[model samples]
Target: MKLGVVGKGGAGKTTVAALLAEAYVAEGRRVVAIDTDSNPNLGISMGLSLEETEAVPVLPRSMLVGVQGDVTADELIGEYGTDTPVGATLLSAIKVTEAGAGCTCGGHATVRSLLSDALADRADVTLIDMEAGLEHLSRSGGTLAHADVLLVVMEPSRKGVLTAARTLPLAEELGIPFTVGLGNKAKRPDDRRFFEDLCAEHGVPLAGVVPHDDDVVAAGRTGRCLTASSAPAVRAEIDAVIAHLDALTG
Candidate 1:
């Protein structure tokens, strides 16, 4: 099951993705949580120590360029796939550099290559924490072209809900069979209801909700991993979302 998790910048996509990765790992599945976000902090969320995250090898410059002018996806993954903690293999689309260079074509090229290939097939549950918004889709239609599902996370606002609504058709057009709305950062019970109602009114499929919790915020602030969080409520919400997805995909 290849899953794509996308949302606004602060919508907790990485947190949810990490939870899903760990959930599937606990289920004894081979889970590869691809951190396609350019910022590349999904490792921290997935329980990688600061040192390990710093040591993650970026997709080499050589991998992006070749004699044919663009290396094949197989070549990139074969050489650059980095395994992380918790039975998950991770690949960052962004190359880590001290130079802080501009124009990230190499990163996008790596993403495009991976998407063009069925690279997610390497694991039992391939969960991708995508960068914020839907530009990644437009930029790599072939990657998501036959995806199993997409979980569009939202913050329970009009724009968030409507943007998720607008994304459904594009996912469908990309040949993604299933897409659902995931309400994240809901501060109250009614927040979930509001998200569902908005989805229903706007034609988006509201699959499930993850409530607001200080544990999540604290982990984000301190750079600690969600796998280390003591909060079960946040985890329970993720499990519920995954359960719903399992039923849908099965």
Candidate 2:
């Protein structure tokens, strides 16, 4: 399964992807987690230290755009993709600043190529951590239509819910076969309902919810992997979401 997780900037989409990738790996699946965000931290979230990931070199930009000496898909993923400590292969899109802060011209194009190549091969599972908003993939002149599941996560606030509403259609417009909504950072039962109602109103099914857990926040402060430090409740919620996803699989 290739699952693309997207939402607002501060939403926990990356957290969801990291946890899912680890869970799949624990089940002995060969998982590949792609960080499509400009500020790539999936490596750290998967347990690699900031310094260790820094040395992994940005994926060569030339590989995707067909520059004079552009590298082939096999060459690109082979040379730059790293086998993470968490048992998942990782590929980070070039950081915005690395390609010039204000302009990310070919950056998305690069990830588009990576995503295409990754999906072309059969794998146990692949999780994509996308940048905020639905524009990123479209802007790349590509469609996430090939991904098995496209999850739009929200936070139960007006802004969060509204963003999910806008994102759902964009994914569908791109022909994303099985797009769904997910509520994150919930503090109470009503929080989950808010997103569920929004999903119903917008015609998108709700996958499930992840409740607010201080342990999730604490993991960030202590610089530890969330799969190891997150509260059991948080993991349980995510497991529920994954179950919902699996049920859709043939």
Candidate 3:
């Protein structure tokens, strides 16, 4: 299954994505968690230490500019562009953590193509932690176009629900078949009902509600995966979300 996670900045999208990836890995599936957000902290959330070796080779300078509409697709994919190290270049484009001169040009299309090709090969699951909002969708040419499921993470705040509502139209335009709302960082039992009613009122599928957990906060602060923390509540919530996703895509 291919899943894309999106939300407003600081909405815990990366945390959820990392947990989802960890869940898939625990199921013995070959998973590739793509951090497509400029924040570049998804890997840190997944407990992956950033290293020079993990640096995805950069795309050719000419191809980078072409992605932003400076050139045609044919030209960008021409012989010179073909020299890009397939997955590495694509990942590097989206991998925000790498610190050389930033890719000011748009390479999201190339990133999407590479990700699609990689998924087609043999990955059991590909989870993409998309940049904060729906902007990436257009930039990447509906990279989430073929995603089996699209997950929008929200907190219990009014702003969070509003942001999810704002992103819905874009997901619809992109032809994402299934879209679900996940309530994260719920501090009170009443918040759960609030999110449920909000989802119902908004016509969004309610996947799961994850309570606010201190372990999650600690994990984030330490740049560690919450999966390894001895927090049953957090784990159970993530497992529930995974189960819902499985049932939706089954």
Per-prediction TM-score: 0.85, 0.87, 0.79
lDDT of 3 by residue, 157-181 (tens): 8777777787678788888778888
**Candidate 1, 1-250: lDDT as tens digits:** 8788888777778888887888788778887666766678888887788788766767643244333446554565566666767568777766436575765555665554454444544567777788888887786434455468999989878888887988898888888889999998999769978997899999998888888888888888998877734778877877788889899899
> By descending lDDT, how would the candidates be arranged?
1, 2, 3
Query: Which parts of model 3 have CA positions greater than 4 angstroms off?
Result: 50-92, 95-105, 115-117
**RMSD of candidate 1 to true structure, Å:** 3.4
C-alpha lDDT values of all predictions: 0.75, 0.74, 0.68
Q: Which candidate number maximizes TM-score?
A: 2
Question: What does candidate 2's lDDT look like per residue over 1-250, in tens digits?
Answer: 8788988888888878888888777778878777877778778888888887666667655355222236654465577778877789888765765443565546666666555544355357878888887667566455355577889888878787778778767777766778788888999768877877877877767888888989888877776688744478887877787788889875
**lDDT of prediction 1:** 0.75
Ranking by TM-score: 2, 1, 3
Colliding pairs, model 1: none
Can you list the residue pairs that collide in candidate 3?
Answer: none
For candidate 3, the lDDT comes to 0.68
